[model samples]
Target: YFVGIIILPTVREMEGREGESEGGTSTATTIRRLEIEITEKRRVIKREQAQLQLLEQELEKARLQASKEAVIASQCVDEWGKPTQWDDTAHEVLKGVFKKKTFRLHQLEAIRAHLSGEDVFLVMPTGGGKSLCFQLPAVMPGHALTVVISPLLALMQDQVYQLDLVNVLAATLSSADDEYEKRRVFDHLRSMSNKGKQAPSPFLLYLTPEMVVKSKELLAALEAVYKAGNLSCIAIDEAHCVSTWGHEFRPDYRTVGQRVRSLFSSTPVICLTATATFDVIRDVASSMGLGQHRQGGGKKMATFRSAFDRPNLFFDVRYKPQSNKDQLNALLQTVQDCTEKFGSSCSGIIYCLSVKDVEGVAVHLREHDVQAVEYHAKMEVGARKRNFELWMKGHVRVVVATIAFGMGINKEDVRFVIHTTPARSISNYYQEAR
Candidate 1:
């Protein structure tokens, strides 16, 4: 009886424990099932979040595209798919921007051609109003921006300042600028590139061709503008640099025209060079995808050759003397005679063969009671620009410099140019002389 009793209780306890264990197993199984359900729900939420983000991006893009179209709608097009003659609003803008009431015949020609979306080659002399032709087109109703390529930083800055004075938005890129200025300009370009959300500002962005070809961000930005159809025109100032063997050849320049053409197939190009020969002109046109092309009923070239002859410029070549002192004396005599003919406070550039020669000439002149400054590539840019301005203001009577001194300079009262040696090419000579 005792054994039966002990065995029975043990068996009953075992049965009871087994029952409790089964209950605990059932609860754990339900917990695992709940955990799996929660995980699947989390995955679904994540996918929904990603999809929501994508939709937001698409919505933003559509909004941006709508704004761009609205701004473009403000512009009217002609039968040729070119911008029409701007309405009274354009006339008002032009009146405020230019100081003059009427355009020159060549200016009018360029303006009409530009509005017609025709590729053009403008060969106007230095100090002529060639800049105005390109500048006026940038102010038209449809153009979002104009990318002006120039080799000289000084020239870019001077042009930007002049543009600003006349109520056009202009900015230039240079390593010389501080961070704040660069950031501000980049922001402006970015917004300008974003399409119709903002009416395109009357902005002109100037950069070296190197910046366009080499800077990834800037190139992306420019490409974006063209892709958006905001590129009015590309005004290649000093466009002869596009040729490999041209004057002021920058290797970077030779590639920019082609790159721009490759990027913007439909965008028109206008190249202005004061001194390109027939061969150089051909090269530039080819690089820009513009040349003697067939339009309408007959074949015609887009090149517009302004007369190169300047009546005010008189040239005289004198052979160098054997003795160094005699050479210096002769040059001094020429300068003295020029001052006697013109006023004593006349402006001139004395071209030296090298930097050392420039320094020597300036020092010699200084020692002999001549007031002059030395300018060369070796000097700091700020100092060089200061000296150039001093000369422009007539504060200095002479500037002894290498060939580095005078491209895109706006001075017109220059009365004499004395060279230590003949330029390597006649084209170069005419350019320096004119």
Candidate 2:
């Protein structure tokens, strides 16, 4: 019947061509052609439906594989503290969490070494993303908590604020945080410690060396984390402080390394500093028990060094005037030039050696119609914080402050940094100059 249906059409068409009218076409022949057309259409529809099903299955498989990879990435390390699929995981967090597209020089090396459970000593200049080295590893899922011991409370507060902006879970323990805030942070840690099967919550904790040594609440929280075997790494910011030879030597910093070692012997230590001489480096390494200095010299640490030279920054030095009025004029002239060049969005710092000088300089600048504010250790905490934020947000053109102003400050558009008096030491000069 099928063959006849096909052949009969040709036969009829041939006969019609001999002299049949167009109307002579039969209904049965037309019906047979329509049936064939419907059959072909049905065949195409069936094939398309099968292809769609196959595609859906493949998509589901891909999704499952991605989910599995995410879990593995979160659990970045194996039982022995060896990295598993770290490259993929680190890059994912770098982009997804930190919103950075690429790692700066020596950044990946420092982070990778620390992730593999090796101590790291990194020397990168200010604004070189030094914090990200430890911070990147700290934010990874399934990674243990990272404790950062820093000497400056201002730096700690600034870092915590910035981290919060990016939605990264970070908390700082300092005199700045109120009792309620401190208790909240401590309670969170305690809760994580109490969870038996659940993993300890991952967070970047910033603390001063004194807090590590003196704060019983902080020590208790740390002990809880330590008992859970969830202490990931300890990063010492401004690690040069560990050396007496360094410019900003604090006796409290000396105890931090020893105390951390005694508590969490196996946790990796990352010491980061912007300025460190050979003597300072050796002292820091030895004091931290890193590299060959470790007991039995088990695993040597990796040192990541990037050149401190920032070619984009230009330096100019001029002799100060002996007269106070002349000094103010010179400073004002320099600041005006800088502000004029950068226009309204200009941000700058004028460092003074004392709180009196900071207030005086700020008053002078304001009298001259310069948008300026004063910040120093002696100022009320709220006032200093408010002024700093005003300067950071470009509401103020310049911040006249003491040495307390610039540490860990992330303002990138700052056009000039004018020191009204000489810094106490070369490292202090270098730190504020940035």
Give the winner by lDDT: 2
Clashes of each: 2, 0
Candidate 1 per-residue lDDT, tens place, 305-381, comes to: 55566787777877779988888877777888788988877778788878988888887777776778988878886
Q: List the residue pairs that clash in candidate 2.
A: none
Provide TM-scores for the models.
0.71, 0.77
Off by over 4 Å in 2: 1-84, 292-297
Candidate 2 TM-score over all chains jointly: 0.77
lDDT of 2 by residue, 33-117 (tens): 9999999999999999999999999999878865654443234322223444687899999999889899887677677777777
What range of 10 consecutive residues in model 2 has the weakest lDDT sum? 72-81
lDDT of 2 at 246: 80
Which residue window of length 10 is worst by lDDT in model 1? 72-81
Clashing pairs in 1: 67-196, 68-196
